[model samples]
Target: DTAVSQTPKYLVTQMGNDKSIKCEQNLGHDTMYWYKQDSKKFLKIMFSYNNKELIINETVPNRFSPKSPDKAHLNLHINSLELGDSAVYFCASSQDADSPLHFGNGTRLTVT
Candidate 1:
């Protein structure tokens, strides 16, 4: 069983459209995170949710938001998606910030 899973492995949408990626982890971790891998393959942390509360929010745009209904799930919602938003969004979880992260296969988002 996959410890972490994300829906819609591939997402293709036009610019200005809004879309969301759903993620879930069954590892019973205390922390969950959202990472974005740009076209250059640089990975950056977007958000971190721990114990049902948002903990770390990087310098991400206001258009990007992370919503967590529970500890096991963290969803990313992007509004007015731009061409710059086209990238692979990965969902990850770990016991703590210092712990190794287990990442989902990642959702490839393409904005044209």
Candidate 2:
């Protein structure tokens, strides 16, 4: 089984449209995270969930939301997408907060 999986490896939408990406992990990890990689390839953590409790990163915009229905799943929702939101979104899971992370292949989002 895949350690981490994300759906819709590619997404293209209008600038003002909203979309969501789904993620799931079977590694039995306790912590899950959502990461965004900008065009410059700078990766930043947007949100973290431990045992289904949310912890948002201060730098993330209010338009981004992370929802964890359970410890093994973390989903990302973007509202009113912008051209600047065009990038790859990654879903990752770690055994613990301090352990190395296992990332999904990533979803490429394009807002035209």
Q: Pick the candidate with the highest TM-score.
A: 1
Which regions of candidate 2 are displaced past 4 Å? none
Reference-based lDDT, each prediction? 0.95, 0.92
Candidate 1 wrongly placed segments (more than 4 Å) = none
Candidate 2 residues 15-63, lDDT tens each?
9898999999999999999998999999998888889988656588899
Pairs of residues at least 3 apart in sequence or in different chains that clash in candidate 2 = none
lDDT of 1 by residue, 26-79 (tens): 999999999999989999999999977999999999999899999999999999
- In candidate 1, the residue pairs with backbone N, CA or C atoms under 3 Å apart (3 or more residues apart, or in different chains) clash, namely none
Weakest 10 consecutive residues of candidate 1 by summed lDDT: 45-54
TM-score (C-alpha, index-matched) for candidate 1: 0.97
